[model samples]
Target: MSVRDLNLPQREPSRGELPSRVTIWEVGPRDGLQNEQTVVGLGTKLEFLDRLAAAGLGTLEATSFVHPKWVPQLADADDLLAKLDRRENVRYPVLVPNERGLDRALALGVESIAIFGSATETFARKNLNRSFDEQFAMFEPVVRRARHEGLEVRAYLSMCFGDPWEGAVAVDQVVTAGRRLLDMGCFQLSLGDTIGVATPGHVEAVLGAFDDVTRLAVHFHDTYGQALSNTLAALRAGVTTVDSSAGGLGGCPYAKAATGNLATEDLVWMLDGLGIDHGVDLDALVRTSAWMAQQLGRPSPSRVVKALTGG
Candidate 1:
């Protein structure tokens, strides 16, 4: 199938050379739907996961193990995991907010877990109720133990670009936090533009700081409409993993200005044009996003989905 076959807006990479193939970490389940106001049915969430895997996304962030008081929408994480008809050759990673969350994930024998640490002080205080350094200290034991127990750990560093309270953040600060997390046993680090303020230049500078760009993943929110462009910038800089939410569903409860994440359908459309083998079926992805949109009773916000579905 070609880009025209999928009704995607044809565009070429505006920057440097691109990777031959990229790995997309689908975060629709945890990062995207968690911010939704309505309580999505457990069966609906399960079906969404199945459809995404069928669409060829191998790595899916399933659910967050945070306490119900924090994210009530995902209180069914346990039930969702237990009742899920697990698919082979597809990974379901869950978010662990703290040591207690790790305990819950351990009970389920989770293979991969992601923990978040913020780059700015204000977000750290608001999200974790701790100082910037304090949050790392808290994550240290959790990461160490989880790694020791044989689990693939991913670390997310939020607010790598501009911050609402602190204005523009320095690239050095992001690298420092990312390096700390990597040294602490996180196999891969995801740099998050939590407020969706990152530009292409910032993407290059941050990825340039890392010794090995392959160990880093770029997670961009679409609030500023820079996610795709910034992802291209990361690819130009040698980063291969891109994190996106299906149907563009996302927001940050802690970050007041955070909006939706970059939609997987849109990302795949661009990757299709770039000839980057992401292993995603555009039609299946659009159908899956459309199905989820119907379940939510709202149109999918992805441009590609809207164009293909004629929404």
Candidate 2:
């Protein structure tokens, strides 16, 4: 489907909702720690998630169920899910790449799973080792099976704005892929600026192409220092959810220059300044980031952490 085919009305929010409050889905435990050089024990991962929940984060990406050969870091997906302290208001989502991953997640009684696809064929091939069509076909059964098992499904479309191998992705391609996932019963779709090259304009253009039936979330990296700006653009466009990491953890291993996901502490600071309610304890969250940084043997990339703790 083309951008024009989307047929969405431009309903700009009134002054009261100019800078709307957004739901921050913390991906620190899974996406953040998975890329760390030092392997964090399963117990530590659980503790980190517990602190994140205590800090008032309602949604957390708990782990990925990929094969051990592909991502050895998340090989403990079953153990992580089994030991999770499932709260009444919080959701713990795991990434499931295919039927095998889905079976493992389902076996562990996971209620929600995220499946990913790439906007560009090149990225799809490199990231999933399949063509766009092949990857979609692979995930279709996973989504259908999850729905049958009464599980909520989320779709992540990476490299929505640009790709390392293929530059300047068309807005239509992103919309098309997004619509397909939504049509397949994905509860939400996360549009990812995988290489962190997106700007505010790109955010607007991409979001403008989607209809209201599909809930949207923004995932950005800080490679070019555009993550926060792009997030603001998405918020202005009425996006209600965002994906971020604690202490700015997890840069793309595939993209050399890409930075980490947007820092949760920094995002909270911005939300607080706008009088947006995130319910997260900024001080505690900062300390959590510091703790993670110490574990990783690196300085926390969150500006709020550096400023608050004098790191």
- Model number with the top lDDT: 1
Q: List the RMSD of every prediction in angstroms.
A: 2.1, 7.3
Best-fitting candidate, scored by TM-score: 1
Candidate 2 residue lDDT tens string, 58-118: 9999999877776778878888888888888999999999999988888898998999888
- Which pairs, if any, clash in model 1? none
Q: Report the number of clashing residue pairs per model.
A: 0, 0
Q: Which pairs of residues collide in model 2?
A: none
For candidate 2, the clash count comes to: 0
| Ten contiguous residues minimizing lDDT sum, candidate 1 | 8-17
Candidate 1 stretches greater than 4 Å from native:
1-16
lDDT of 2: 0.85
lDDT of 1: 0.90
Write down the TM-score for model 1: 0.95
